[model samples]
Target: MLNSINTNPGALIALQNLNATNTELNTAQSRINTGKKVANAKDNGAIWSMAKMQSASSSSLNAVKDSLQRGQSTIDVALAAGDTITDLLMKMKEKALAASDTSLNTASFNALKSDFESLRKQITKAVDNAKFNGVGLVDKSAKALVFLANADGGSFTVNAQTLSLEGLNLTTALASFSTVAEAGSMIGKMTAALLTATNKLSALGTASTGLDTHLTFIGKLQDSLDAGVGNLVDADLAKESAKLQSLQTKQQLGVQALSIANQSPQSILSLFKG
Candidate 1:
């Protein structure tokens, strides 16, 4: 190779190698700092795009999980109210049966009627208050609760059940037991109301169970998506660290080689001085 003072090819080649080494060292250092192999589209365009899409999917599933949890809470409140109403129905039925006996005096019959009315009123209150997030599933104007099942606007609905006073035929006006016949009829109505409440409870329980199962599936799906994204974009810190050290060493050697190549042109001056 001709060592010329005006243009040193060896120095130019050494400088080019040094620049390439510096570029590689910077990339390894960036991976180490960010802990991601594909931090941006420029790093690995296809892999970065895929990872971003999966991450967005995981976020959408997280919203679904939130909806499921809220739905569970609503169902839980309704179930609890149904249980209390069932208990109140049993007590009201007992009062009605005691009032049906012919031996009971007027005062005793009225006392039993009063207790029955109180218990029936309590059932109405229970149904009225069986609400969560401003939604009552066991009320006169109850509506089905809808929850998102996925990010794509898919949904599940929980049917509402009315357990109000008029719904159970245990309203204040109809709760009187003036005769044995009336008391017996009241007992039958109470039995039917109890059955209705229990059936509603069963349905709500099933819905809650379904929500729980969906939530579990969503959790697993999010985990799988996250793992996939990580696989596509996450950097191997150990490997990057090793690469950074090697590149640093190579960069130092490149600079030294360039320096030596530049000095070669000065050696040409010695030929003319003699």
Candidate 2:
């Protein structure tokens, strides 16, 4: 049986052509405004899915970067405080040697000992107070000195154990040492503690250097990810410019074609007039 719509082929064909042309015109307009061919997942499901995957990876990396930054800052604070403590210990040694002077009596030596003792307390205070975001780096709080991040956005536990200076009890260093031998013994103990601090600081410094290198790599990764995202989403200005020109011309021509198509129906009116 002949379809009822086929009875008026001219009107049906004209309407169909108009709808198709209108769709193309709208697509071109959308691309022009958004500067993206795939504005949403519906544009191309597979390609959009891949872009989302890449986006998810980038997000994970970004989170890692934040933690790495915080770790680096914590190390930096610890490093600075370690340096000051190293200097303080050296000064304390100078005072210890001054106490051993033959001319200095028990009372004079006691004054020097008091100053050295005060410096030791200051060193302990510095360590106890060394904190980044309320997490102590040098105190008994943290077991490790360095933190490393893994690829899956989870932190990989690296052995960064810091040496605890808590056990170096220096209470006796405060009391007056009468004999030169007593002062010398105190100096010896203090020197050993200083050496230990130096060694630990060296280890911490090495770990911090490694973290700095990792941070640099992460920064590069972020840059690469940003460039990749741009490649996927950003319109190539040169290509889009050319496309814009072509679409403009095609739109003008499409309007003209539609105008001409509409005129085909007017021919029936002309026939009646004749």
Candidate 3:
């Protein structure tokens, strides 16, 4: 090629090649630093958009998980209280049964009556205290609870249970173990109330199990969504590392090539000097 100081074609070509190498090297370095091939919309618009959408979904599931966890904890508190009420009912049954003995003396009967009343009051206390996150499952404060199940606005509901004395059909009149006949009547009521409390506990236990199972499913689903986002955007560090090394070497070579091309005009100077 003809050499000119004003326009050396070889230097122009070398500079163009070097610029191309520099661009590629910059891209490799960016990937290595960010650990992502498509870190932004400029990287790959379509893939980046998809990855952003999936990542948003994965993040939203965090809220859903929180809802489920709160629901689970609320149910756990109710279950604990229900179990306590069940045990207290069993003890109340024993107290009422003992009070039913007609041969018992007045002093003994009064003492047994006082004991039964104390147990009944304890059951009320358990029902009142079965609350979490401002929700009471056993006290009839909340009719039902709904928890977010997924990113699509799906939900699960846990029906509330009223375990109060009146709710269980165990009237305050039964709390009056003041006489032998009343004591005898309380035995039958206690049995029925015990059955009701046991059934409620069984149902609550099932609800808790369902919550646990769905929580596990949500966790796995979130993991899958995260993996999907990674697949769409994450760069292979090993491949990027190798590519960066290769590009660095090519950049050095490109600089040397441009330097040699720039010196081509010096040969014309040598000819003129001789």
Candidate 4:
């Protein structure tokens, strides 16, 4: 190799190596600090795009879960109201049976009728109050509750079952039961109403169970999508840590090598002095 005072090829080569090592060190430290192998699209365009799409899907599924939860709550409220109405109907049946006895005085029959009327009004109140998130599933004219089942706008519907007095055939006018004979006839109607209400309650319970299962599936699906995104973009911290140590050592050695290369040009000066 020809020695020159003006230019040192050795120094240039060492500087280039040092710069490369520094670049590698920076990349390793960035991975450690951010904990992401592909923090931006520039790192890996295809992987970043795929991860972003998966993340969006996960977000949509979260919304679907929320819808399912709301639907479940509505069904649960309606089921509770139906059960309470069933109890009220049983009590009303007892009162009707008592009033059917011809031996009862007029005053005693009136008192029993009043209690039955009150119970009937309470059933109406219960059905009206069985609302969740602005939806009344047991109201006299309830609409179907629809919940998103997936990110693609597909839905699951919970059909509303009315549990009101009119729906249950228990809305007979109080004035229509003036005679003990009429009160006796109401027993059969009340029994049929109770059966109808019980069936409606069972249906609502089943719908609630179905919604719960859908929610569980949504949760599991979201977890799986999240894991997939992580696999695509998450950094291996242990590997980054090891690379950081190795690059740091190389950086130090590169600097020393550059210093030694810079001193080589000075040797040409010594030759001139001699």
Candidate 5:
């Protein structure tokens, strides 16, 4: 080619090649720094949009898990109180049996009656206090507790088990151990109350077990969604590192080639030298 003083074709070609290399180098660095090939819509619009949707679902499930856990805890508190009331029933039954001997003196009979009354009051106290997060499941206060099971508006309900003195038909006024016949009547009531309380405890226990099983499933579902999002967007760091090194070497070579092209015009000075 003829040497020209005004323009150098080689320099223009070299500059174009160098600009191309710089663009590739910037992309490699970005993948390495962010660790995601499709961090935004510009990278891969379809994949980015899908990943965002799945991430939102996983986040919503976290709230669902929290609600289920609270429901489980409420049932646990009620179960604990139910067990305490059952034990108190057995003790009250023993007090009534002793008072029904039909041969006890007035002093002994009155003492036994007082003990039975004290134990009866304890059952009421236990029922009133079986609360969690301001909800009493076993005291006839709440009909049921419903917890979120999924992001799609599904739910699980734990029905209340009313185990109070009024619920068990063992009213405070009927608890009279002053006479042998009255003490015998109380013994029969204690047996029926024990049966009712045991059944309620079983129901609460079954609901608790169901909640635990569902929580395990929710955890697994969240993990699967997270993994799917990672598959769609996460970059291969090993591949990006190798690409970065190759691009850095090519960029350095491009700069050297541009410098050589710029010097080509200087050789024309020798052609016109004195």
Candidate 6:
């Protein structure tokens, strides 16, 4: 059986060519409007996957940076508490010096002992209260932040050990300072307190510095991820403009060629008679 051609062949060819031209024009328009070659995942499968990966990385970096910032803040709380503890120790030392005075009588010595013990109590209390959102770097309960080894898809941990301000080695603090002798136990209590305060201060300072270092690293990582995302998905205006002009030219040429193809069947009409 022959395929019957009832319609004008020239018109059919013109219609087909026009449809192709229209399709090309629609594609060019889409790219121009969206400012991206792969506006949808369906446009370019591999490129879309790469873009999604970049986006996820950028988001993960931001989250890590935020965690670092919070960690730094937690360290700040510990550091402040450490400073207070040192101050209390200094006050205890002052009271000890007063008690050491040779002229101090029994009542005066007793009073000095009482004041030094009170100050020691205050330091302990201060350490206990210094906490940021219940994450105490000082006062014994300190926790380190953990992150995945890979940004996505992994079972891993970035373990930073919890440190404590309450770990000060205050040996024989109240015991040695309780007695008022010729040497005046004030010196011993005060000395021990100073040593404890010193170690606590050092630990907190070290921890704070480490927090700053980690935060800085996280910030840099965020910046790097942002750059990668830009490279992968962001438009280059200059390049896009050039491409736009080239596509416009191609689109125009395509239309003209389609018109010429439509004329092919028109030539056949010259041999036809009614």
List clashing residue pairs in candidate 1.
none
Tens digits of lDDT, candidate 1, 19-105: 999999889988889999899999989999999988999999988999999988988898899889889889988999998888989
- Between candidates 3 and 6, name the one with more favorable lDDT: 3
Whichever of 4 and 5 has more lDDT, that candidate is: 5
Q: TM-scores of all models? A: 0.93, 0.81, 0.94, 0.93, 0.89, 0.73
* Pairwise TM-score winner, candidates 2 and 3: 3
Per-residue accuracy of model 3 over 1-274 as CA lDDT, tens digit each: 6667888898889999999999998998899899999999999999999999999999999999999999999999998998898888889889899999999999999999899888888888998888997788888565888999899999999988878887777666756678888889888988899899889878888998999999999999999999999999999999999998998999999999999998988888887874
Give the candidate number with the greatest lDDT. 5
Q: What is the C-alpha lDDT of each candidate?
A: 0.87, 0.68, 0.89, 0.89, 0.90, 0.63
Could you tell me the lDDT of residue 10 within candidate 4?
94
- Native-vs-model 2 lDDT? 0.68
- In terms of TM-score, which candidate is strongest? 3
Model 3: residues >4 Å from true position, as ranges? 270-274
lDDT by residue for model 6 over 82-152, one digit each (tens)?
77777877777788778778787888888887886777677668877877777665555555445332355
Clash-forming residue pairs, model 2 = 145-160
lDDT of 6: 0.63
* Worst 10 contiguous positions by lDDT, candidate 3: 167-176
The deviation in Å at residue 270 for candidate 3 is 5.1
* Model 2: residue 4 alpha-carbon error in angstroms: 16
Backbone N/Cα/C clashes per model: 0, 1, 0, 0, 0, 2
Put down candidate 5 lDDT per residue, 212-265, tens digits, no spaces. Answer: 999999999999999999999998999999999998999999999999999998
- How well does candidate 2 score on lDDT at residue 186? 69
**Runs with alpha carbons beyond 4 Å of true place in candidate 4:** 173-176
Error of 2 at 250 (Å): 2.3
